[model samples]
Structure formats: C-alpha cells, structure tokens
Target: MNKYIEIIKNAYTGYWNYLKHELISINHWDNYFYGLLCISLIVWLLEICFPWRKNQSIFRNDFWLDTFYMFFNFFLLNLIVLIALSNTAAQFLNDILSFIGISISSFQLFDVDDLPKVLGLFIFFVVGDFIQWNTHRLLHRIPWLWNFHKVHHSVKEMGFAAHLRYHWMEPVIYKSLLYIPMAIIGGFDAQDVAIVHFFNIAIGHLNHANLGWNYGPLKYIFNNPKMHIWHHAKNLPEHSKYGINYGLTLSLWDYLFNTAHIPYNGRDIELGFEGDENFPKDFIHQELYPLSKK
Candidate 1:
C-alpha cells in the first residue's frame, strides 16, 4: 500500500517536472513536445499546399478536437499516468522474475552491439512496427478493444493532427505488447528508439493528412496517405470485416500477410463507422466512451 502511494506521488511530481521542462526548456530539439509541434506544423503546411481534397477547408471538421487529442495523448496523459505506471510495472515484473531465479536480460535474442548501428536500428524499427501492426489488428477484431479504437475512427475528416487522435488506452495496449518483443531483441538505446519514434510520427502524420501521395512503387513498402485513407473508410468490403491496411510505419507487413487492400483512389471516401453520428464529440465523453455499456 505504501509502495503504491509512493508511486502515485512520484508520478504526480514527475508529471509536473516533465511538463515544465517540455514547455519551458528548448535545449533538446529531440524532445517529443517540440517534435510533435514541429511535425504537425510541417504536415499542416503540406496539407495546405497540396491538399488532395481541394474542397476540404483548412480548418476542417474537428480539427481543433483532434489537435487537443494530439497533445493530450502524447504529453499530458503519457507523463501524468503512463510513465509511473509503466515503471512500476517493470519493477514488479523484474521482482517476480528474480524470485523465480530468472533474469530478463538472458532473454535477449541477440546482442544488438554485434550488428552495425544502422542495421540494428533498422531491425528494431521493423520488429517494433510489426508488433504494433498486430496490435492494431487486435484493436479492430476484438469487441472491447474496438470500443476504444472507435474514438480514432470517429474522425469525419482527415488531417495530420488526426494521426494522434486515439484513446489514451491505445498506448497502454500498444506499448505493453511491444515491450516484451523489443526487450528480447535488446541493446538499443533511447536515441535509437527516438529516431524510429519520430520517423513513425512523421509517417503517421502524412498517412492521416489530406495528401494524396501513393509513393508509386514504394507504396508496397511505406504506408502513404492514399493507402491509409482506405483504412478509415466507413464502408469496408465484406472480405475485410475486421478492417484492413493495418500498417503502422510500413505497408510491407500488410502485403506479406494478405491484409492489404486498395480498391480505388480513396481520396474522397467517407470516414468513420456506421453509427459514428452518435459517437461522442467532446474529449471527456470520448475518454469514457469505451467504458460505457453502449
């Protein structure tokens, strides 16, 4: 009980300190707080310059709402709740493993130091993306998870900020599943993960932006706006009942697993699900939406 209380208190303090640093300090260019703003600005400019949907307004539907989601999910919820919780969970798991006379370090599949830094980072990126890809499919296929994921699909219009408009629980789910696999292939540092993280953020913003870029032949490798817009299509084909285009950073997994589907240009396809009209529009309501019986 005391340990839990200490954890909570530390979480509160850590949240405030991190928040202050992120907001006030400009020393680190790689900080996510700044990175998110920079990426959003760049993508917004791209959307303004070469919008696929010419008729879509610059301040499209729920633009501000999605922007709020971006900061909330990335910083507020993450620093305040997830950081301490994840640390405590890791410690608890390690303690349990110690009691069982096992060391988590022994589970490493290979020493990342043995490979070149670039190759190691590439492997880490691909493996991490594959884990997220599978986790994304679970969000659509599982009823309980789909309830939370619906907050993302409720987007009526696509924008770069829309990329981060997902329920906070999503990180918990994605990171929890990613932890084991990533740890098993260990030796990469925070900088390595940050490189991949920021890159994925950029790609994700592009994928959700109102930019009709297919990357032509590269479409089979990297996910693009044209390919990802179909992922949010309200009317999916019967064959893809659970959803399709479950790619995170790369479309290679989708193609390899036979889940890739692009029947048309998808520039003007209707977004959201069947009953999206009734979905909550406000942030607070949407946060509690998944817990509701409805």
Candidate 2:
C-alpha cells in the first residue's frame, strides 16, 4: 500500500513539475479579469439562448439579490478557506485526509491547473450535484430530512441569487462530504480543482438563469437553464422531477433514477413552495425559520 501510494504521489508531483517548467505561462491578474469577463459573456449568451423560463429577464428585482448573493458567496468561501489555511496547524487540520491514507498534498489539492482543468471542473460539478440530487430526493422522501432540505425549496423565485439562497447548513452537509472525500481520494491537483470550481460557478449561474437557449439534444444531455427552472417548480408533480439534471454538466443520473422530467411545453410550469407562499428572504430568517416550531 505504501509503495502504491508513493508511486501515486510521485506521479502527481512529476506532473506538476512538468507543467510548471514546460506549460505556457499564465498572467494571474490578466487571466482572472479575462476569465470573469468570459464567464459573464457566456452567462449572457445562455440567458439569451436557453432561458429557464419564458419571460425571464436579468433586470428583474431578483437581479440585485443575486448580485449580492454572488458577492457574499465568494467572499464567505474565500474568507473561510483563508482562515483554514492561515496557520500551519489549521492548514493541516483542513487537510487531515492525507494522514488517513489519502495523499493529495495541501498545495496540490487546491491550485487550479490547466489541460485537465476543464474536465476536472465539470466532473466535480457533476459529482457534487449528484450528491445533492440524491440528498434532495431523500429529503423529500423522508420527512425528517425535509426540515432541512425544504429551506431550498422554500425559495419562491429562480435567479442567480437562488443559487445562494440555500440554507448555510445545506452547504456544510453537501459540500463538506463531497469535497473532503474528493480531496482524500486525490484525482486532480489544486489548480485543477480551482478551474473546475470556476466552471461550476458558471454552470450554477446558467442553471438558475432566466434565459431561453434550448439546444434540443444538448438540453436532453446537459442540464440547461430552463430544465433547472422547472426543478424549482412548486407543483407536486413538477417537484417530483427532483432528480433531473441534478449535476451541472450532466443529467444522466436523473435519467438513471427515473426523475428526469421532459417538458412538453418547453417551459417551467411554475415557482415557489407547494402551499407556503410567504417564504422569508432575510438570511437569519431563512436559517432559523426552517428549524423553528411549526
């Protein structure tokens, strides 16, 4: 086992060394600004092409809410990761899986590398979303878990902010489990992970976008924005399509699980909770209200 591990570790290191020495150089600042611009442009195109809803518009009241959500979501995640990496002890704790037979080194686990970057990004999104779909389906099937899961369903609207509207605990459960396991298993390097995560951000936005792109077969395979909008529907039958396009890149799981919903009308039926029309928007209220005595 140790020999196998060492081999894997060496291969991983060798790949990085080769990349650093032979791969094309990247200007981090220029790349970051350009990356953001490209993402924004793609999002805009997606909105124009495959709008999840028929009348979706970027200028709606929810625009500001989603913008704020994007800001805070990035801020919170960066702050948490920074804090986790600040101290040597904290950093080790953040990467405890290595000590337990897993071998992704700290630096290698989080840096965004190129080449494998695109594939890794989409794969991570799919894996994470698969976890989410199963958990969500389980939540609906078992009333106990519904208490926590319903917080997401409670959102009465579908927009970029809807992506951020999830209860904080939701992320703690889903993201921690998925991320920790991936880190320990060790596939892509840190750079690969970052690039993939950036890809995920675009997918997340596209999933909740108010766009109109419907690339027929592509819609069937990939979870287009419209498909996700339907997932946000409040109707019982519509909500039952919970598993379709659970991941950002693929909908195969939804098909496998028999939760894939094919829209005959090419539009999302409706939005919000089944019976609860007065879901609150305040962060504290969203966090605390779901658990309070009903």
Residue-level lDDT tens digits of model 2 in 89-160: 233555575567654455354432443656656656566667666665665665555666666666555665
Model 2 misplaced stretches (Cα beyond 4 Å): 1-57, 77-129, 139-145, 238-245, 266-268
Best by lDDT: 1
The worst-scoring run of ten residues by lDDT in candidate 1 lies at 86-95
lDDT (C-alpha, whole model) for all candidates: 0.91, 0.56
Per-residue lDDT for 283 in model 2? Answer: 56
Each candidate structure's TM-score, on Cα atoms with residue i matched to residue i, is: 0.95, 0.66
What value of lDDT does candidate 1 attain over all alpha carbons? Answer: 0.91
lDDT per residue (tens digit) for residues 56-123 in model 1: 99999999999999998888887767877776777677778999998889898897879999999999
RMSD vs true structure, all candidates: 1.5, 8.8
